[model samples]
Target: MADVEYEPGSEAASNILKDLQEKLQTDTELQERAQELILNIQDIRASVNAAKAGAGTHRRGGDEVQLIAVSKLKPASDILALHAAADGGQVHFGENYIQELWKKHAILPTTISWHFIGGLQTSSISKLARIRNLYAVHSIDSAKKAVTLNRLRPDGFPVVNVFVQVNTSGEDSKSGVEPEVDGGELWDVISTIRKECPKLNLVGLMTIGAIARSQAAKEGEENEDFVALVKVAEGLEGRIEREEGVKVELKLSMGMSDDFESAIGIGAGFVRVGSSIFGARPKKADASIL
Candidate 1:
């Protein structure tokens, strides 16, 4: 050790040097991670813009296309980050699982509206009905489900907005009503709700886009499917309006990360997005993640 006289500022200089060393170590990785997140955000914005542009010249009514960010199985932090970036309180989020949705709702601000985007069982009706800011329910495909929801809805709230899900592709495993069903049966179910269900408001119809492997194939196929669903909705719109004694504003809740542009172009008022905004989901331990 040099036992010579040390300079007066040596201790102060050493302390500053130590602080800088620690800060450099801590901030470099943090800055890199932040930069990566920014780049990802840019990519998401580009995709969204492309979708909006591809949607093309559809006369936007007073209502714009509402983007419901599907946050199923995603961490709450990711949702927070998205909310921070959004403007005009425009972000509406959707969740598939009841428990996860509840958890996220607990952590997220009340200002953000939540949509139940999954097939809701009767047992979960009470929990869903109690959520004060639930913007809409997108999977009310059956009269029974509608009845259950009507029964459980809390007093003093406006009727919960609901979309009748139609299975346009006629897939056996899918969870929506077939759009090409008997007219009597369809009208019976829909009319029953209009007459009887006081707490549920029939706002629109939702259908899944035809799932295809390639982007071009998916777009072409889904455009056909979307056009079909739109025709079905258009066919029923006047009927529902006549029965309800008011012009029913019908929303077509179709499209996802892949085919939303086509859906939008064909008049999708609501588009559900998940992986496109949150990035690729982490693979499940046993199941393949989509």
Candidate 2:
């Protein structure tokens, strides 16, 4: 695949679209699937926006809940199709695998904002930093990784926006700082990032919540994890403004494919949706590319 970056509608992108057209024309199944995905995304976007309107948060200059299409394990063609389906092109897409994201970033139009939404190793900071269009990173778990990313930011780029991941679920296997005020662990992480790393903007908090909590949320049972994240955000509000020396909307990014609407209703500034738009991904063994 070509590694050169292209602007949307440029000659290179046009060539890519030509190839995409050929693929879609030859594969009826893929064409139908792509169309279906586009409709699904549209519906989800409307629902999320509507929820935000009714939630009464946007009235105070709060950020509209952004839809980040999680594109991990899906083909780049799927991303391109979704981008083309929208008028302004899809502004945000999230990827977990570093190598896979890099490959897609190299080929996709630079207009698309790529967000790294996975557990990141400190070693990969330099590589990810080099991505020219990385809009934000959503899974920053520690002060160490945040410092590493700040130190390695690519030259000439503005600050890299980042979210401190809170393991609200309390899963031992999860990657995030514990959201506890008693010990001040979360405070230390956020304060250290803000005071020490000028290259990284401590923009928000994110969490996966517990797997069991997801079912509760689906059944309309209030998710304690989600509630915890909201409380964490509220608690940090004054500290965030004080530390930044300017009023900043410390966003909460705590929704997924299943409960994004619920998340939006609770003032989530961003929601990550994947399978509901792209359909089920193939088995892990099917993942190739980089």
Candidate 3:
């Protein structure tokens, strides 16, 4: 093909138009992705609404579901877009690894609140405590972890919000306090933290429901877990409130990308969503990435 020469102004205009077209296409794709997210969010919201309506029939407080988008393993760009869409609403973002979270927080604005959603080792507690906007630590299942967090909390912060993770399914490999109706040893641990660890606030309870093959199966199973967590929270609420002298709010941090709706229906104040919000994550090379 012969090279066709054009006037300088004409060539500039043509290049500008091509750039604009590409930008428009990129915007369209982004909008489409955002719309899909909004639909999924609406479905979750609807489930919470139905649960709230049903709660009125009973004498309990209506379901007040708080969606905590699990942003672990996703790119910072994706988190920024999701937060922009949220429009300043207080949305909780959950992270698994301390290093990954530190990187994300460094890049992301401090206004976005975060929850540490993974297992906490004694060593990492000091670093986790330093993050100013860390709203809650969801996997504080044992006294050891609680003590570590209490010791590491920065000065001037009244208390670090935390949840006692209860393993309702009794799986040995699961990461939570084994559910005890009497609150058993865990109760004593909570009391110790309350009394000794002046900087830590035992806010509520959390758990990971038994995994199921499909979304429907997951939802059915998680609903029971969610309800059980609520009962546990209600049971502990009286004692914790009386002792702490602060209204101990029961926050249920359950649900993944799969069964969030059911979790909300049973009153999950915070649902941790991962893949559904950020899309499938890239595979990690090793355990270090986690």
Candidate 4:
């Protein structure tokens, strides 16, 4: 993709964003894009709808499924093009790096609802909390991180949505709280969120399940990782209601580009799609979070 040339200034964000979106929406022949870079908003939306219609496990109805465009290694221009392709309505985007996330947030329209879907750590907690338009955080794996994030959230701001990441696949490389919740680490953190973290809204459970699980779902088998996430959500909801005296309906965030169709079909509240919507992204060797 060619570098997006636009005037720089605080006032120029919406203007530039709108201008780029208009041009891209109209497919104005300004620059040729790689075959992999083509934005396919229509196809992605249609596929999501189709999957929803065929959903056999959607618990809360198909209309509740939401798509979070996982634009991790993609550029701002591609985001603009996709936004334009959706007639400026598809605004939710997922990012991995705190640094890249903020930089893009600074340049893009604040109307965009950003979801941080990468590993959350102590070093980047404050910066992530400071994002003005952050819609949700899908990688909160620890209680301390959750507490600190809640404390760092700007005063008077609406509680930012939070999803407790669970390592359902039990993969050593994955980052999430363990699936156990019977007075274990997962239970402790969830309790902390409901009782101590007032600035954070515990909205759902998220997981980066094994690729094998994704493939298995496509083959008409159960994605145990997703099933585990749903179980956790149900367990937490019951516990929270009984102990904390708060009625809560936790959502599920377990689908990705590879298995989103099956995930939505299983009634996931949010599906993070990347390559299918914005095309394949080159690998990030040393992605910065600061």
Per-residue CA lDDT of model 4 for 232-288, tens digit only, reads 787888888888788888888978878888778666889898878766677786432
Q: Model 2 misses residue 73 by how many Å?
A: 0.2
lDDT of 3 at 56: 57
Backbone collisions counted per model? 0, 0, 0, 0
lDDT, candidate 2, 69-184, per-residue tens: 99999887788778877455677999997777877776676778889999999878887887778899999887888888888887688778899999998889888888885445
Using alpha carbons, what is the TM-score of model 4? Answer: 0.85
lDDT of each: 0.68, 0.79, 0.68, 0.77
* TM-score, prediction 2: 0.86
Q: What is the C-alpha RMSD of each candidate to the true structure, in Å?
A: 12.5, 3.6, 10.2, 4.3
Q: Candidate 4: where are CA atoms >4 Å away?
A: 1-39, 56-62, 86-88, 217-219, 285-290
- As a whole number from 0 to 100, the lDDT of residue 92 in candidate 4 is 90
Residue 244's lDDT in candidate 1: 62
The regions of model 1 sitting more than 4 angstroms off are 1-63, 86-90, 181-185, 213-222, 241-245, 283-290
Please provide, for model 3 over 1-290, each residue's C-alpha lDDT reduced to its tens digit, 9 standing for 90 to 100: 01122222245434543443344347876567666665655565566567566545442334466677777776654555566565443357889888777656554556778889898888888878877778889888778888888887888864678888888767787788767746576686667767787787766778888655224454235456766778888877777677667776566777776766566656667778777666777765422211
Model 4, residue pairs in steric clash: none
Off by over 4 Å in 3: 1-43, 54-63, 86-90, 213-222, 238-249, 286-290
RMSD of 2: 3.6
